[model samples]
Target chain A: MEKTGADGFDGFVTARWSALFHLARLLCGGDRHRAEDLLQEALVKLWFAWPKVADEAPEAYVRKIMGRAAARSARRRWWGERPVDRLPELAQTGDMSAAVAERSRLETALAQLTPRQRAAVVLRYYQDLSEKQVAAVLGVPVGTARSHASRGVARLRQILADVIDPVG
Target chain B: MDHFEQELARMMRDSQEYIPFASEQRERLREGVRARRRLRAATVAGGSVLLVAGLTAGLFLLPKGPAVDRPQGPLTRPGTSSSSSPAPSTSSPAVSPTQSHAPGTPTGTGTTGGSSPPSTFPSGSVDPTTFPPNPPATTATAPATSTVAQGTRTARPPVSSPPAGSHSSG
Candidate 1:
């Protein structure tokens, strides 16, 4: 229950090291360079906390820590508004282009979502967590998790609307 | 889930990329942990040395009260001359001046050699309040003296991690 020092930190590193890297990748928007830096910083924080929380799941706690860390490092907005991302046109409609467009769409859509909403989506979809599990992991109510996921998904659809239904 | 919902879920799955966590990254993390532990260990060791020195010094160096005013002590039999009990313990006080600085000034008597510089008061100087009749010295609160001495976190937490290949987090 009580983590003393090195033992707790080593246990934490063994448990969630991989998951933390993935989280950094997502939070850093596919920028593996920045993701690595962010993850190292996050791990350093976990090291600082290892003594007190050695027995707990390091991944879950670290995920919450990453949330706070990313928020702190987030690009500031102009009056609480992030400019909408301009979608790359679907030229030629080839599978390669379509895939690229879709990836961009997903990334841009995620960029549009609030940090919390993006986190909810990543935890739900990428981590394959159930709503309840996401809620518990994020330390939020299940309803709140569901709402973030729903709204995030809705916005993604809206962003893709023009690309898919060219006539509409 | 509706078709679109299912597709959206699949879309996130499709976007997922493998992140190869190199051995180097893990080493970096482990090293960071080791460094922090070392730092904490150094802090405790340093503090402990200071505490022992202070207690020893306070036992001997600072303004000790009248022999009759000697407070309770585990080191002494009750009602014995307090003078004999503390003087022996204080033999090692110089080893930890920082640790014993406050305890020396029990009740703010502020007579710690550390606090009052001999250079500040010329050899022949005497305060007007103390005139020809040197006033009887006052004692400080025992509780206050001890509190100042023990300011760091006293609670020690348990930390156990079995050797590698001995236990698993799974």
Candidate 2:
């Protein structure tokens, strides 16, 4: 029974890791390491709750955990800093393509918004969740969730105006 | 949704690059679960210990009924019941002076002075006329009479002594 549960959990995490990581990235406003940390933290909690939520929606559980953690971490900014023996790799401009440039611009714009705004925008637009669903996940009122998404979209539009044509 | 919103959603979807769940991450997750489990166990164990300790301390600190109910000091001892003994004087100040002066003088009212003679009647029967008109103090020294009188006087209230004055006058 234990082995089957473990296998089920592993298989689910392995299958959904990429999608969950992406959501975590967006929720964290494009901080790759922070997104990885957030995803890992949510997954650990999911391991404990797997028995209850496994037959239902484990992905939704993970998404809720990540969203709430991302929102809460805004007050505790120390998680962004870490003692590292080696410096991180900088973005290479040598092999830069339009897609990579666009991705970078998008991430840069996302990073400009607060954690809550970024999470709301990502959940509403990317995950295709309604404002009420976003509010439930973030533990906020629907009006607040809608406000966060609208304000986030407004900010993103201002930042990505030059790249994304307004005519389309 | 507007065109910009559509474009924004498209861009968000396109930005996702697939990342496989690696062994390193799996190991880290297992470690986190184990660490949390150990922390929970320790917290429960420590809390139980503290609760038991608090209850035990409360029990030990409680006052004992038997110890408190037992009378204190030699003054309360039965050996000091003799009329001549000064211990009863210190213990019961009200009865002591009457016992001491009862053998020498006929103190008036006999309320205080007559207290010692009533205990001498072991049969619980005493004729009021047996009390001398002028003095009940003469009978105060008789050991059998004085002991019985003192015992009775200590047990019964002084109001019972008024009958002695009534019969003494008759």
Candidate 3:
């Protein structure tokens, strides 16, 4: 019985590792090292809780844990001290340069958001979760989730407006 | 999804292109789980040792406080029949040392003052009709001293006899 359970847990870990790591990277604001640590911590917790989690959607369970862990790590560390990635110069007007500039501008703006706001935005837009679903994952009220997502997107648009398009 | 939302999804996909998720991380995660379990087991063992030590210390320290301080046996010990009486005074064990000693010292002085008979006498008036039904000062203070000093002293006359047992035992 125990061996089968272990095998199941191992299989789940192997299958979900990449997708969860990708989520973790976005949640960690594209910091590969921090994302690796965050995903590893989430996986460790998932392994220990396999018995309880086996009955539920393991991906959602791990995502919720990762979201909370990322939030907690953000609180403890001075991530705000790290400067934003430099935005491309406004005068470089080539088509290819413009798209790369917009992407970098969007990333820099996303990195500026508070961890909760960023997580809510990523889960709501990137993962295609409803405000209610985002709330469940973030352990917040639906209204709070909606507000975080709206405010995060508004901030991102404001920051990236010149790079993406001058129009709203 | 709105245009901004679609852009966010695209941006996230673009950002995560470089992070390589490896199979070895599963073993790393399992190692972490084992370390956590060991830490939790150590914590439980340490806490249990501390609790057992605390209880053992409490057991030894408790008896050293003087056996007399234990709540007096039963209200039955007083041989008093009034059931309602014990309620107010049952709290007397803790109150005994301070309350009893305060009144006891003055009575001791009064007894030695050659006014022993006046102090010793329970009711000063010969007419029982005029006397209050309860002479609580003597009754209450008497048991308090007796119970409080039981380990070190003998019982004494209830009225105004000085608690020589308390003084001598001290």
| DockQ per candidate, 2 decimals | 0.16, 0.71, 0.27
- Runs off by more than 4 Å, candidate 3: A78-106, A162-168, B14-23, B63-170
Descending-lDDT candidate ranking = 2, 3, 1
Whichever of 1 and 3 has more DockQ, that candidate is 3
Candidate 3 residues A28-145, lDDT tens each?
7666678788888887877778888887888998899988776555667546535355543444546556455545555557677778888998888778888999998998899998
Q: What is the Cα-based lDDT of residue B84 in candidate 1?
A: 36
Ranking by TM-score: 2, 3, 1
Which 10-residue span in candidate 3 chain A carries the lowest summed lDDT? A81-90
Each prediction's whole-model lDDT (CA): 0.56, 0.74, 0.64
Docking class of 3: acceptable
Residues B1-170, model 3: lDDT tens digits? 66656766776666544334465765677788899899989999999999999999999898879886777764432222433342323222333343333445423322232222333322222111222332344346686444355311111233223345457777
Query: How well does each candidate reproduce the native contacts, as fnat?
Result: 0.29, 0.71, 0.44
Q: On residues A15-38, what C-alpha lDDT tens digit does candidate 1 reach at each position?
A: 555666756666555456666777
- Candidate 1: tens digits of C-alpha lDDT, residues B1-170: 55556666676666655555568887876687688779889999999999999999898956655665877665633323333333223222333323333333221221222122223322222121222221212113354433332221100001111223245553
**If chain B of candidate 3 is superposed on the true chain B, what is its TM-score?**
0.35
**Candidate 3 vs. true structure, TM-score:** 0.62
Can you tell me the DockQ of model 3?
0.27
